[model samples]
Target: MNLKATLEQWRMFKAVVEAGGFNQAAEQVHKSQSSIHHAVQKLESALGLTLFFNEGRRVTLTEAGELMYRRACYLLDEAHKVESVANSLKSGVETYLRIAVDIIFPPEMLYKALNKVSQDYPLLRIELMETVLNGANTLLKEGEVDLGISPFPLNSGFSEDLCEIDFIAVAHPSHPLHALNRVLTLEDLKGHRQIVVRDSSTERKAESGWLGADQRWTVSHVRTSIDIIRQGLGFAWLPLAIIRNELETGVLKPLPLEQGGLRKALLFLCFADGDRLGPAARAFLGELRYQTMSLPSVESIAE
Candidate 1:
């Protein structure tokens, strides 16, 4: 069967939709606007479908466009996966590895794993992105990261239960909420401010943690949220992995809640395409698992 449209045309079409217009798509993909326009026109002609209607400078997808867009995305993803699989089989150790890790994952463990793996492959490059919430999952799905440590229910890829992060509601000892000197409730928390870490994903919908308080501040990192909390401005449910020192030093104190003071997020080790994993990616995964095996949880890390 002969197909009228090429993957490049679909790629161009997808890029135009994502970038909002042909001109933007041109800039994004490093192609001229004329070429993008021609490709999209050709795609619509071949399929006999109207994919976009243009505003002054923007393009909006028609209903049929939306349907084709989704199918095109899937097609493009599968095409990339096939190329990756072929490359893995023919190539030696990958020269570089990209990993996306949820911020809640222990930094020490990551550093140790990378260091251990790098010892054997001195020239291997690593790109480590510290993401929040769905960020790692999105990166893995988009094939941006070869590996990831992210919360489960991923849209794509293979995942295994890895570890859990213990989050506790905490605030500065000087904050008025602590002055009550009793088990705190959500009602009590409502009067105060809460700091939350922003999700790093670009396209898909993402959530900042619990918006429990009337006043809220959103930041890009957990450390930023912790820093604001330490300043007596707000309170938040923070992961214990990074806040242990602050807890011991009295820089922060846990909310005395009757119930629901703590929460847990189970993270998983995800592969971008597990069966087609390159040699370096495989080695890195093995080293990461080996390093994580010794520490069961944050409680065990302290021991």
Candidate 2:
């Protein structure tokens, strides 16, 4: 079969269908209108069917055209995937890194760490998938992502505790709870409206299954939740790393919780038989550990 010819015709037909006319398709595909017309004509002849109903200035797909469009789209997408894989193999470029990340590392920290690693390993490339918890476990186990940074308890057997972020409840100084220095009991917060960022995963167990869940308002991200806390909307549990600036500036104050402090365990994960992290991912993770103060000794959460 003339595969190249079939592909060329498919391209022309798709361009015409998407661009709404032969002339427009020519402009988009950088071919002459006559060339596009000829290609589509050849395609129809080869398929033994009329693809479109010709009406002046408007072209509508025939029944066959509709069916072919669906199939053609899948074919092109598969072709592109094959091409991408071929190029990666030929050039020896690492094409994708499926990663799971805790929302704990805000954008700035994540970028800085990645930047440092990219410096030494220029050929290394990445496609990162970020999630708050174990959402990316399936991809990691299936070897889709090279590694994932998630919180414990991890779904995969091959995992290591990479970081720890102490959780601190904070509120504005003028808020009534501020005078208490640190109200270390749950009862202290019962009377005041609380703000929380909800996480359904096991890592978010701190806030999960709370009978007091209704007393607090929920926000989607830490930054926004902290912003509301600054405005004195309510007190919230936040990572100490994230609130350091606010604490120093007196924009926010940590409340005394019942426990000495709330802490969370962060884990780095890979498939049980996965290869060691490439230079880039490894370098980035090393920097991440340093920046987040997660280094020195890696510890497991108490059983």
Candidate 3:
């Protein structure tokens, strides 16, 4: 028996299985109904198996047909990936991209953007570094990263205002601050310990959002500060994105400050050189920008 199977034959079989009939499959594959039917016949003949059973004009897959269909789907997917990788390489997409993101930025937003890039450029390598405050800026200045998302603008790079992150002063529900029962003032917070995240930069060590509380505990990362606050160790102003679940579950409660419990930090996305960015870096930036636009604007929420 002579056996010959082609990619086109497998594609026709898949389309027929998915579209429910040869006529519909022909419409999808841009082939005539007879051609689609003939391709499946040849495919079944090549494998020496009955792939489908016909009942009048309707058709259904046999057990062997279902198995072949599953294998054909895998083969087609792998073929598409091979073509995609070839095109990416020909287009000069970078093999490796390093991005420094501010720790205060929402993790979900970052992951969503990175996930999209991975789908488009599967061959690209990504290095993600989470930094605090000016740490991203430092990385960009040192030429250690291709892109940087910082809360503050860098001195020598192309930058754009990405989005504003809302920070809320919060404490554990069982903390003494919540027991005050009234709108607490700055003076009232001075006696309690404040959990502050130290700036990650080795040179500057800049600090922000300190309320001059007499007692303080400094931590390196925002996550650490949040964990400490959740334990009722101290109160800290944290990004609302990181603590939404805690706020909903009554684990953490926003402190009612006289001035306002929330503050907005403007974030910027900077490139070492916009003109020099490779295709992978540019595509990643585009995805990041698109996802940032979907986030809630500062005006949408009460200050």
Candidate 4:
């Protein structure tokens, strides 16, 4: 039994179980409240237990300090991602990247691949994050982003495809389904009011391209379901490159759906490994695959 626990006594027992004691974990680890109570009393006397209990001045953790504060927060987040990939390979790049995207992925090809990675990595630091459907695969499965375009195709990392995205089903040129729009159907959009959007996945909640209308309305951005269907307050399905100027000037119209109002999607591009990416996430994923090969596909949005 020679353990001698340390990562500075599991970072002073996770800063006194997240600063609830030892004088606010010695003012949050700046040390000395008698060195964070002698490093959590030498990590509970080298793990013989009794992690925390005193309630008078508050400090509660105890079931072996909630399993050693969830394994010392996964060993201090894998030792801060091994000191952030050894300071991004000794500062050759990636001082920050993040990404995430997917708000129908095509804001002018993500502003021309972030204006050519800010004129070739002008000191990295990107971040971005938009998100919507599967919300960029829930921020790349919660590593909280480091590249993820997404539309679907993720089942565990390194995807690619990257493009497609059409959708249409609009409305609002004086709504009332554009005055009995000639092609409209699904029982004339089951009594109007659809909008939708939502699904930013906290863990589940998804509903894509809804038709279950019974006066729907959800909305959580796709530019707030195209500004609440441009104020006519309904009919949604957007992203024809974000309603190409509300379908060119008429301020939105397209509901001629005798079957389904367009649709396409695709998109991909995820990450999580591309050889442990860096150098500004491999130069903004080679300018997001050379500006997603000059977009406009899905048979040019079905003509």
Could you give the C-alpha RMSD of every candidate to the true structure, in order shown?
Answer: 5.2, 8.6, 16.9, 13.0
Q: What is model 1's C-alpha RMSD?
A: 5.2
Q: Name the candidate, 2 or 3, with the larger TM-score value.
A: 3
Better of 1 and 2 by TM-score: 1
Tell me the tens digit of each residue's lDDT in model 3 across 154-211: 7876889998889899999889999989999989999999988878776688665888
Candidate 4 structure, TM-score to reference: 0.42
User: What C-alpha lDDT do the candidate models reach, one value each?
Assistant: 0.85, 0.67, 0.86, 0.79
Clashing pairs in 1: 184-256
Q: In candidate 2, which residue pairs get closer than 3 Å at backbone N, Cα or C atoms, i.e. clash?
A: 98-145, 182-256, 184-257, 184-258
lDDT (Cα) of model 3: 0.86
lDDT value for model 2: 0.67
Best-performing candidate as measured by TM-score: 1
Which residue pairs in candidate 4 collide? 185-188
Runs in model 2 deviating more than 4 A are 1-93, 106-109, 138-144, 179-184, 200-214, 258-261, 269-273, 290-303
lDDT of 2 by residue, 1-303 (tens): 555348788988988899888888888999999999999999898888899987876578999999988888768866765775566556553534456666665556677787786676666676776555454465565456666666654464477666666666678988887777755677777788777655634433344213273367876567778889899878877777667767777898767677634655555644433334444556666787676663222122211
TM-score for each candidate, following the candidate numbering: 0.74, 0.57, 0.68, 0.42
Candidate 1 TM-score to native: 0.74
Candidate 1, residue 241: Cα displacement in angstroms equals: 1.0
List ranges where model 3 is wrong by over 4 Å: 1-91, 296-303
Q: By descending TM-score, how would the candidates be arranged?
A: 1, 3, 2, 4
